[model samples]
Target: MCGRYATTRSSGTLSQLFEAYDDTDGRHRPDWNVAPTKPVPVVRVDDAGERALSLARWGLLPPWATSPSAGARMINARSETVATSRAYAGPFARRRCLVPADGWYEWARTDGGKQPYFLTRADGDVLALAGIWSVWRGPDGPWLTCSVLTTAATGALAGVHERMPVLLPPTRWEPWLAPTGDPSALLGADEEWLAGLEIRPVGAAVGNVRNSGPELTARVPDVPAPRRAREDPRSTAEMPLF
Candidate 1:
Protein backbone atom coordinates (compact mmCIF):
# COMPACT_ATOMS: atom_id res chain seq x y z
CA MET A 1 0.00 0.00 0.00
CA CYS A 2 1.26 3.51 -0.88
CA GLY A 3 0.36 5.48 2.25
CA ARG A 4 2.98 8.18 1.80
CA TYR A 5 5.22 9.44 -1.04
CA ALA A 6 7.24 12.43 -2.26
CA THR A 7 6.92 15.03 -5.00
CA THR A 8 9.48 17.78 -5.40
CA ARG A 9 8.94 18.78 -9.03
CA SER A 10 8.12 22.37 -9.84
CA SER A 11 4.68 23.20 -11.25
CA GLY A 12 6.24 24.14 -14.56
CA THR A 13 8.07 20.82 -14.87
CA LEU A 14 4.98 18.84 -13.99
CA SER A 15 2.88 20.77 -16.50
CA GLN A 16 5.36 20.11 -19.27
CA LEU A 17 5.75 16.44 -18.39
CA PHE A 18 2.03 15.79 -18.28
CA GLU A 19 1.21 18.17 -21.12
CA ALA A 20 -1.17 19.98 -18.80
CA TYR A 21 -2.76 23.10 -20.28
CA ASP A 22 -4.21 24.76 -17.20
CA ASP A 23 -2.37 27.36 -15.18
CA THR A 24 -0.97 26.29 -11.88
CA ASP A 25 -3.19 26.80 -8.79
CA GLY A 26 -0.08 28.13 -6.95
CA ARG A 27 -1.35 26.51 -3.77
CA HIS A 28 0.80 23.39 -4.24
CA ARG A 29 4.47 23.55 -3.41
CA PRO A 30 7.30 21.08 -3.47
CA ASP A 31 6.77 18.47 -0.75
CA TRP A 32 9.31 15.81 0.12
CA ASN A 33 6.89 13.98 2.36
CA VAL A 34 3.25 13.96 1.16
CA ALA A 35 0.75 12.03 3.24
CA PRO A 36 -2.80 10.90 2.59
CA THR A 37 -5.73 13.38 2.92
CA LYS A 38 -3.49 16.11 1.44
CA PRO A 39 -4.06 17.67 -1.96
CA VAL A 40 -1.93 16.19 -4.77
CA PRO A 41 -1.61 16.96 -8.45
CA VAL A 42 -3.43 14.69 -10.85
CA VAL A 43 -3.57 14.68 -14.66
CA ARG A 44 -6.89 13.96 -16.29
CA VAL A 45 -8.55 14.53 -19.63
CA ASP A 46 -11.29 17.15 -19.96
CA ASP A 47 -14.22 17.30 -22.39
CA ALA A 48 -12.08 19.20 -24.87
CA GLY A 49 -9.53 16.39 -25.33
CA GLU A 50 -6.88 18.24 -23.41
CA ARG A 51 -5.15 17.09 -20.27
CA ALA A 52 -5.55 19.33 -17.24
CA LEU A 53 -3.33 19.19 -14.20
CA SER A 54 -5.39 19.73 -11.09
CA LEU A 55 -5.16 19.16 -7.37
CA ALA A 56 -7.46 16.64 -5.68
CA ARG A 57 -7.54 15.28 -2.18
CA TRP A 58 -5.54 12.03 -2.05
CA GLY A 59 -8.36 10.01 -0.53
CA LEU A 60 -11.32 9.21 -2.76
CA LEU A 61 -14.82 10.15 -1.63
CA PRO A 62 -17.65 8.34 -3.36
CA PRO A 63 -20.81 10.22 -4.38
CA TRP A 64 -22.83 8.33 -1.77
CA ALA A 65 -20.51 9.22 1.06
CA THR A 66 -21.94 11.41 3.83
CA SER A 67 -18.59 12.95 4.78
CA PRO A 68 -15.02 13.34 3.47
CA SER A 69 -13.75 10.89 6.05
CA ALA A 70 -16.02 8.24 4.58
CA GLY A 71 -13.41 7.64 1.88
CA ALA A 72 -10.32 8.51 3.84
CA ARG A 73 -9.74 4.81 4.33
CA MET A 74 -9.73 4.30 0.56
CA ILE A 75 -6.61 6.13 -0.52
CA ASN A 76 -5.88 3.08 -2.67
CA ALA A 77 -8.04 0.71 -4.71
CA ARG A 78 -7.02 -2.82 -5.51
CA SER A 79 -6.75 -3.27 -9.27
CA GLU A 80 -8.57 -6.61 -9.19
CA THR A 81 -11.71 -5.22 -7.52
CA VAL A 82 -11.86 -1.72 -8.98
CA ALA A 83 -14.33 -2.73 -11.66
CA THR A 84 -16.70 -4.34 -9.23
CA SER A 85 -16.34 -2.36 -6.02
CA ARG A 86 -19.26 0.01 -5.50
CA ALA A 87 -17.09 2.87 -4.29
CA TYR A 88 -14.83 2.66 -7.36
CA ALA A 89 -17.08 1.20 -10.07
CA GLY A 90 -18.30 4.51 -11.50
CA PRO A 91 -14.98 6.30 -11.38
CA PHE A 92 -13.28 3.23 -12.79
CA ALA A 93 -15.52 3.47 -15.80
CA ARG A 94 -15.22 7.18 -16.54
CA ARG A 95 -12.89 9.11 -14.26
CA ARG A 96 -9.47 7.60 -14.85
CA CYS A 97 -6.38 9.74 -14.20
CA LEU A 98 -2.60 9.84 -13.80
CA VAL A 99 -0.94 10.44 -10.44
CA PRO A 100 2.59 11.80 -10.82
CA ALA A 101 5.20 11.02 -8.24
CA ASP A 102 8.95 11.19 -7.88
CA GLY A 103 8.79 7.90 -5.97
CA TRP A 104 6.77 5.99 -3.37
CA TYR A 105 7.56 4.51 0.06
CA GLU A 106 7.06 0.94 1.19
CA TRP A 107 7.96 -0.74 4.48
CA ALA A 108 9.59 -4.11 4.98
CA ARG A 109 9.99 -6.11 8.15
CA THR A 110 13.30 -7.42 9.55
CA ASP A 111 14.21 -9.27 12.70
CA GLY A 112 15.04 -5.95 14.32
CA GLY A 113 12.10 -3.82 13.18
CA LYS A 114 10.21 -2.37 10.22
CA GLN A 115 12.38 -0.55 7.68
CA PRO A 116 11.29 1.85 4.91
CA TYR A 117 12.41 1.83 1.30
CA PHE A 118 12.06 4.36 -1.49
CA LEU A 119 11.40 3.01 -4.99
CA THR A 120 11.74 4.96 -8.20
CA ARG A 121 12.19 4.48 -11.94
CA ALA A 122 15.78 3.65 -12.75
CA ASP A 123 15.83 6.50 -15.30
CA GLY A 124 14.55 8.99 -12.74
CA ASP A 125 11.38 9.81 -14.67
CA VAL A 126 8.23 10.64 -12.75
CA LEU A 127 5.95 7.68 -12.17
CA ALA A 128 2.58 8.08 -13.89
CA LEU A 129 0.56 5.87 -11.58
CA ALA A 130 -2.84 4.72 -12.75
CA GLY A 131 -5.56 6.41 -10.68
CA ILE A 132 -9.27 7.18 -10.62
CA TRP A 133 -11.06 10.33 -9.48
CA SER A 134 -14.53 11.24 -8.26
CA VAL A 135 -16.64 14.31 -7.47
CA TRP A 136 -18.49 13.81 -4.22
CA ARG A 137 -20.97 16.05 -2.41
CA GLY A 138 -21.86 15.87 1.25
CA PRO A 139 -23.43 18.03 3.95
CA ASP A 140 -20.35 20.23 3.98
CA GLY A 141 -19.76 20.69 0.22
CA PRO A 142 -18.41 19.02 -2.88
CA TRP A 143 -14.93 17.57 -3.14
CA LEU A 144 -12.65 16.27 -5.92
CA THR A 145 -10.84 13.18 -4.76
CA CYS A 146 -8.81 10.29 -6.15
CA SER A 147 -7.24 6.92 -5.28
CA VAL A 148 -4.18 5.15 -6.62
CA LEU A 149 -4.59 1.72 -8.20
CA THR A 150 -2.36 -1.12 -6.95
CA THR A 151 -1.41 -4.40 -8.56
CA ALA A 152 0.81 -7.33 -7.61
CA ALA A 153 4.45 -6.38 -7.48
CA THR A 154 6.91 -7.69 -10.08
CA GLY A 155 10.66 -7.93 -10.71
CA ALA A 156 12.73 -6.25 -8.00
CA LEU A 157 9.68 -4.95 -6.17
CA ALA A 158 8.33 -8.45 -5.62
CA GLY A 159 10.92 -9.13 -2.94
CA VAL A 160 10.00 -6.02 -0.98
CA HIS A 161 6.22 -6.26 -1.06
CA GLU A 162 3.41 -8.23 -2.63
CA ARG A 163 1.65 -5.16 -4.05
CA MET A 164 2.73 -2.05 -5.94
CA PRO A 165 1.00 0.81 -7.69
CA VAL A 166 0.04 0.20 -11.31
CA LEU A 167 2.18 2.41 -13.51
CA LEU A 168 0.80 3.49 -16.91
CA PRO A 169 3.36 3.56 -19.66
CA PRO A 170 3.71 6.68 -21.81
CA THR A 171 1.95 5.05 -24.75
CA ARG A 172 -1.04 4.13 -22.62
CA TRP A 173 -1.36 7.54 -20.97
CA GLU A 174 -4.01 8.89 -23.36
CA PRO A 175 -6.23 5.81 -23.14
CA TRP A 176 -5.88 5.60 -19.36
CA LEU A 177 -6.55 9.31 -18.87
CA ALA A 178 -9.81 8.95 -20.80
CA PRO A 179 -10.97 5.49 -19.88
CA THR A 180 -14.48 4.28 -20.76
CA GLY A 181 -16.38 1.29 -19.45
CA ASP A 182 -14.08 -1.16 -17.55
CA PRO A 183 -10.34 -0.60 -17.42
CA SER A 184 -9.29 -4.01 -16.25
CA ALA A 185 -6.91 -4.28 -19.23
CA LEU A 186 -4.67 -1.69 -17.57
CA LEU A 187 -4.62 -3.44 -14.25
CA GLY A 188 -1.79 -5.88 -14.90
CA ALA A 189 1.89 -5.24 -14.34
CA ASP A 190 4.36 -4.75 -17.19
CA GLU A 191 7.38 -6.93 -16.53
CA GLU A 192 9.68 -4.83 -18.74
CA TRP A 193 8.54 -1.65 -17.07
CA LEU A 194 8.95 -3.19 -13.65
CA ALA A 195 12.50 -4.18 -14.51
CA GLY A 196 13.39 -0.52 -15.07
CA LEU A 197 12.76 0.39 -11.46
CA GLU A 198 15.06 0.38 -8.42
CA ILE A 199 14.66 0.50 -4.65
CA ARG A 200 16.85 1.71 -1.78
CA PRO A 201 16.49 1.22 1.96
CA VAL A 202 15.91 4.47 3.81
CA GLY A 203 15.68 5.57 7.45
CA ALA A 204 12.65 5.12 9.69
CA ALA A 205 12.31 8.90 10.32
CA VAL A 206 9.66 8.87 7.59
CA GLY A 207 7.48 7.03 10.07
CA ASN A 208 6.51 10.42 11.51
CA VAL A 209 4.32 12.66 9.36
CA ARG A 210 5.90 15.85 10.73
CA ASN A 211 9.35 14.96 9.35
CA SER A 212 9.91 16.40 5.84
CA GLY A 213 13.05 16.82 3.73
CA PRO A 214 15.04 15.24 0.91
CA GLU A 215 17.03 13.37 3.52
CA LEU A 216 13.96 11.53 4.68
CA THR A 217 14.48 9.24 1.69
CA ALA A 218 18.24 9.05 1.88
CA ARG A 219 19.86 5.62 1.91
CA VAL A 220 20.91 4.24 5.31
CA PRO A 221 22.76 1.13 6.47
CA ASP A 222 20.46 -1.70 7.49
CA VAL A 223 20.52 -2.70 11.15
CA PRO A 224 19.05 -5.71 12.91
CA ALA A 225 16.55 -5.58 15.77
CA PRO A 226 13.98 -7.86 17.39
CA ARG A 227 11.34 -8.86 14.85
CA ARG A 228 7.72 -7.90 15.15
CA ALA A 229 5.08 -10.09 13.56
CA ARG A 230 2.91 -7.18 12.37
CA GLU A 231 3.27 -3.50 11.60
CA ASP A 232 0.81 -0.80 12.59
CA PRO A 233 -0.62 1.22 9.72
CA ARG A 234 -0.24 4.44 11.69
CA SER A 235 3.51 3.85 11.78
CA THR A 236 3.61 4.85 8.10
CA ALA A 237 1.72 8.11 8.52
CA GLU A 238 4.90 10.20 8.44
CA MET A 239 7.92 10.54 6.15
CA PRO A 240 10.04 7.34 6.36
CA LEU A 241 13.61 7.61 7.54
CA PHE A 242 16.28 5.68 5.60
Candidate 2:
Protein backbone atom coordinates (compact mmCIF):
# COMPACT_ATOMS: atom_id res chain seq x y z
CA MET A 1 0.00 0.00 0.00
CA CYS A 2 3.00 2.36 -0.30
CA GLY A 3 1.05 5.35 1.00
CA ARG A 4 4.21 7.30 1.85
CA TYR A 5 7.91 7.25 0.91
CA ALA A 6 10.97 9.47 0.40
CA THR A 7 12.98 11.05 -2.43
CA THR A 8 15.84 13.34 -1.44
CA ARG A 9 18.12 13.32 -4.50
CA SER A 10 18.83 16.56 -6.29
CA SER A 11 17.26 16.95 -9.73
CA GLY A 12 20.71 17.18 -11.30
CA THR A 13 21.63 13.84 -9.84
CA LEU A 14 18.36 12.34 -11.03
CA SER A 15 18.85 13.81 -14.51
CA GLN A 16 22.25 12.14 -14.77
CA LEU A 17 20.93 8.89 -13.34
CA PHE A 18 17.99 8.67 -15.76
CA GLU A 19 19.75 10.38 -18.69
CA ALA A 20 17.05 13.00 -18.75
CA TYR A 21 17.73 16.17 -20.80
CA ASP A 22 15.39 18.64 -19.14
CA ASP A 23 16.76 21.31 -16.86
CA THR A 24 15.88 21.11 -13.18
CA ASP A 25 12.65 22.88 -12.31
CA GLY A 26 14.35 24.23 -9.14
CA ARG A 27 10.95 23.96 -7.42
CA HIS A 28 11.69 20.41 -6.32
CA ARG A 29 13.56 19.88 -3.09
CA PRO A 30 14.55 16.84 -1.10
CA ASP A 31 11.56 15.35 0.68
CA TRP A 32 11.91 12.57 3.21
CA ASN A 33 8.20 12.02 3.76
CA VAL A 34 6.31 12.15 0.47
CA ALA A 35 2.61 11.39 0.94
CA PRO A 36 -0.05 10.26 -1.49
CA THR A 37 -1.46 12.60 -4.20
CA LYS A 38 1.66 14.76 -4.05
CA PRO A 39 3.69 15.54 -7.16
CA VAL A 40 6.86 13.47 -7.57
CA PRO A 41 9.50 13.09 -10.22
CA VAL A 42 9.01 10.47 -12.96
CA VAL A 43 11.19 9.42 -15.89
CA ARG A 44 9.58 8.46 -19.19
CA VAL A 45 10.75 8.06 -22.74
CA ASP A 46 9.28 10.80 -24.86
CA ASP A 47 8.28 10.36 -28.49
CA ALA A 48 11.70 11.69 -29.51
CA GLY A 49 13.39 8.71 -27.83
CA GLU A 50 14.92 10.99 -25.19
CA ARG A 51 14.31 10.38 -21.55
CA ALA A 52 12.66 13.29 -19.78
CA LEU A 53 12.29 13.88 -16.09
CA SER A 54 8.88 15.30 -15.26
CA LEU A 55 6.67 15.76 -12.21
CA ALA A 56 3.46 13.82 -12.04
CA ARG A 57 0.86 13.28 -9.37
CA TRP A 58 1.73 10.04 -7.60
CA GLY A 59 -1.62 8.35 -8.32
CA LEU A 60 -2.95 6.85 -11.53
CA LEU A 61 -6.09 8.38 -13.04
CA PRO A 62 -7.65 6.37 -15.83
CA PRO A 63 -8.96 8.34 -18.77
CA TRP A 64 -12.44 6.99 -18.04
CA ALA A 65 -12.48 8.28 -14.47
CA THR A 66 -15.06 11.00 -13.90
CA SER A 67 -12.72 13.03 -11.69
CA PRO A 68 -9.08 13.20 -10.71
CA SER A 69 -9.73 12.42 -7.05
CA ALA A 70 -10.35 8.84 -8.08
CA GLY A 71 -6.58 8.54 -8.52
CA ALA A 72 -6.08 8.74 -4.78
CA ARG A 73 -7.22 5.13 -4.58
CA MET A 74 -5.09 3.93 -7.50
CA ILE A 75 -1.60 4.65 -6.29
CA ASN A 76 -0.48 1.04 -6.63
CA ALA A 77 -1.24 -1.79 -9.05
CA ARG A 78 -0.56 -5.42 -8.23
CA SER A 79 1.92 -6.82 -10.75
CA GLU A 80 -0.12 -9.97 -11.26
CA THR A 81 -3.34 -8.15 -12.13
CA VAL A 82 -2.29 -4.81 -13.65
CA ALA A 83 -2.33 -6.16 -17.21
CA THR A 84 -6.06 -6.78 -17.04
CA SER A 85 -7.48 -4.26 -14.56
CA ARG A 86 -9.58 -1.59 -16.21
CA ALA A 87 -7.90 1.23 -14.32
CA TYR A 88 -4.43 0.04 -15.33
CA ALA A 89 -4.79 -2.05 -18.48
CA GLY A 90 -4.01 0.63 -21.09
CA PRO A 91 -1.11 2.23 -19.25
CA PHE A 92 0.43 -1.09 -18.25
CA ALA A 93 0.53 -2.05 -21.91
CA ARG A 94 2.14 1.10 -23.30
CA ARG A 95 2.71 3.89 -20.77
CA ARG A 96 5.49 2.35 -18.74
CA CYS A 97 7.83 4.68 -16.79
CA LEU A 98 10.31 4.77 -13.92
CA VAL A 99 9.78 6.28 -10.47
CA PRO A 100 12.96 7.33 -8.67
CA ALA A 101 13.04 6.97 -4.92
CA ASP A 102 15.76 6.93 -2.30
CA GLY A 103 13.74 4.60 -0.09
CA TRP A 104 10.25 3.40 0.84
CA TYR A 105 8.38 3.04 4.12
CA GLU A 106 6.61 -0.07 5.36
CA TRP A 107 4.79 -0.73 8.60
CA ALA A 108 5.24 -3.76 10.84
CA ARG A 109 2.53 -4.46 13.36
CA THR A 110 2.91 -6.00 16.78
CA ASP A 111 0.58 -6.38 19.77
CA GLY A 112 1.72 -2.97 21.03
CA GLY A 113 1.52 -0.98 17.80
CA LYS A 114 2.78 -0.56 14.25
CA GLN A 115 6.34 0.55 13.54
CA PRO A 116 7.61 2.24 10.39
CA TYR A 117 10.65 0.85 8.56
CA PHE A 118 12.67 2.50 5.85
CA LEU A 119 13.93 0.16 3.14
CA THR A 120 16.69 0.96 0.66
CA ARG A 121 19.37 -0.65 -1.44
CA ALA A 122 22.58 -1.42 0.41
CA ASP A 123 24.61 0.09 -2.47
CA GLY A 124 22.93 3.49 -1.83
CA ASP A 125 21.70 3.74 -5.40
CA VAL A 126 18.38 5.39 -6.18
CA LEU A 127 15.65 2.77 -6.63
CA ALA A 128 13.94 2.93 -9.99
CA LEU A 129 10.48 1.50 -9.19
CA ALA A 130 8.64 0.10 -12.19
CA GLY A 131 5.73 2.47 -12.82
CA ILE A 132 2.94 3.06 -15.35
CA TRP A 133 1.63 6.49 -16.30
CA SER A 134 -1.63 7.82 -17.74
CA VAL A 135 -3.17 11.09 -18.83
CA TRP A 136 -6.50 12.13 -17.25
CA ARG A 137 -8.49 15.09 -18.39
CA GLY A 138 -11.16 16.70 -16.26
CA PRO A 139 -12.94 20.03 -15.96
CA ASP A 140 -9.72 21.56 -14.67
CA GLY A 141 -7.35 20.32 -17.42
CA PRO A 142 -5.04 17.49 -18.37
CA TRP A 143 -2.87 15.75 -15.81
CA LEU A 144 -0.09 13.21 -16.08
CA THR A 145 -0.18 10.60 -13.34
CA CYS A 146 1.53 7.36 -12.40
CA SER A 147 1.31 4.35 -10.09
CA VAL A 148 3.91 1.90 -8.80
CA LEU A 149 3.76 -1.84 -9.43
CA THR A 150 3.98 -4.27 -6.54
CA THR A 151 4.96 -7.94 -6.48
CA ALA A 152 5.04 -10.64 -3.83
CA ALA A 153 7.82 -9.79 -1.39
CA THR A 154 10.83 -12.09 -1.11
CA GLY A 155 14.00 -12.50 0.97
CA ALA A 156 14.27 -10.26 4.05
CA LEU A 157 11.45 -8.07 2.78
CA ALA A 158 8.98 -10.93 2.90
CA GLY A 159 9.35 -11.03 6.68
CA VAL A 160 8.44 -7.37 6.96
CA HIS A 161 5.58 -7.37 4.47
CA GLU A 162 3.94 -9.67 1.95
CA ARG A 163 4.28 -7.17 -0.90
CA MET A 164 6.99 -4.91 -2.30
CA PRO A 165 7.34 -2.63 -5.26
CA VAL A 166 8.72 -4.14 -8.48
CA LEU A 167 12.31 -2.94 -8.78
CA LEU A 168 14.00 -2.82 -12.19
CA PRO A 169 17.73 -3.36 -12.36
CA PRO A 170 19.90 -1.59 -14.95
CA THR A 171 19.83 -4.57 -17.32
CA ARG A 172 16.03 -4.79 -17.22
CA TRP A 173 15.22 -1.07 -17.26
CA GLU A 174 15.20 -0.63 -21.03
CA PRO A 175 13.44 -3.92 -21.60
CA TRP A 176 10.71 -2.93 -19.15
CA LEU A 177 10.19 0.53 -20.61
CA ALA A 178 9.96 -0.66 -24.20
CA PRO A 179 9.04 -4.31 -24.43
CA THR A 180 10.08 -5.69 -27.78
CA GLY A 181 9.36 -9.31 -26.88
CA ASP A 182 7.67 -11.26 -24.09
CA PRO A 183 6.59 -8.78 -21.41
CA SER A 184 5.77 -11.48 -18.89
CA ALA A 185 9.41 -12.53 -18.86
CA LEU A 186 10.31 -9.05 -17.61
CA LEU A 187 7.73 -9.04 -14.81
CA GLY A 188 9.32 -11.46 -12.36
CA ALA A 189 13.12 -11.24 -12.12
CA ASP A 190 15.52 -13.02 -9.76
CA GLU A 191 15.60 -12.14 -6.06
CA GLU A 192 19.36 -11.37 -6.26
CA TRP A 193 18.43 -7.93 -7.56
CA LEU A 194 17.27 -6.94 -4.06
CA ALA A 195 19.44 -9.24 -1.95
CA GLY A 196 21.62 -6.40 -0.68
CA LEU A 197 18.66 -4.33 0.43
CA GLU A 198 18.52 -3.06 4.00
CA ILE A 199 15.68 -2.01 6.26
CA ARG A 200 16.02 0.36 9.24
CA PRO A 201 13.45 1.12 11.89
CA VAL A 202 12.44 4.78 11.65
CA GLY A 203 10.51 7.12 13.89
CA ALA A 204 6.72 7.06 13.63
CA ALA A 205 6.58 10.78 12.77
CA VAL A 206 6.14 9.64 9.18
CA GLY A 207 2.78 8.16 10.10
CA ASN A 208 1.32 11.64 10.12
CA VAL A 209 0.78 13.05 6.66
CA ARG A 210 1.25 16.63 7.82
CA ASN A 211 4.77 15.97 9.09
CA SER A 212 7.57 16.36 6.55
CA GLY A 213 11.36 16.48 7.09
CA PRO A 214 14.54 14.45 7.02
CA GLU A 215 14.25 13.71 10.71
CA LEU A 216 11.34 11.42 9.94
CA THR A 217 13.88 8.74 9.06
CA ALA A 218 15.84 9.09 12.28
CA ARG A 219 16.36 5.87 14.21
CA VAL A 220 14.32 5.63 17.40
CA PRO A 221 14.49 3.04 20.12
CA ASP A 222 11.70 0.45 20.01
CA VAL A 223 9.88 0.89 23.29
CA PRO A 224 6.77 -0.54 24.94
CA ALA A 225 7.65 -4.16 24.38
CA PRO A 226 4.78 -6.18 22.99
CA ARG A 227 3.23 -8.60 25.44
CA ARG A 228 1.45 -11.82 24.57
CA ALA A 229 -2.09 -12.28 25.85
CA ARG A 230 -0.89 -14.78 28.45
CA GLU A 231 1.67 -12.28 29.73
CA ASP A 232 -0.62 -9.25 29.71
CA PRO A 233 -1.81 -7.90 33.09
CA ARG A 234 -5.21 -7.08 31.65
CA SER A 235 -5.77 -10.70 30.79
CA THR A 236 -5.64 -11.55 34.49
CA ALA A 237 -7.97 -8.70 35.47
CA GLU A 238 -11.69 -9.29 36.01
CA MET A 239 -12.55 -7.06 33.07
CA PRO A 240 -10.69 -5.51 30.08
CA LEU A 241 -10.24 -1.78 29.66
CA PHE A 242 -12.13 -1.84 26.38
Query: Which candidate number maximizes TM-score?
Result: 1
CA displacement after TM-score superposition, residue 112 of candidate 2 (Å): 4.0
lDDT of 2 by residue, 1-242 (tens): 57678899888889889888653467677889888788888888777777788788989998888877888899999999998898888888888888899889988765558867788876688898889998888788888899999997765565556688888887877877773555557778466767657666788789888888888876566533223323433323221111
What's the true lDDT of residue 161 in model 2? 66
Q: In order, what is each prediction's RMSD in angstroms?
A: 5.5, 7.5
Lowest lDDT block of 10, candidate 2: 233-242
Name the regions of candidate 2 deviating beyond 4 angstroms: 222-242
lDDT per residue (tens digit) for residues 10-69 in model 1: 877888998896545787787778899988888887767678887889999987777787
- What lDDT score goes with residue 211 in model 1? 87
Clashing pairs in 2: none
Q: CA lDDT, every prediction?
A: 0.78, 0.77
Task: Give candidate 1 misplaced runs (Cα > 4 Å).
Answer: 222-242
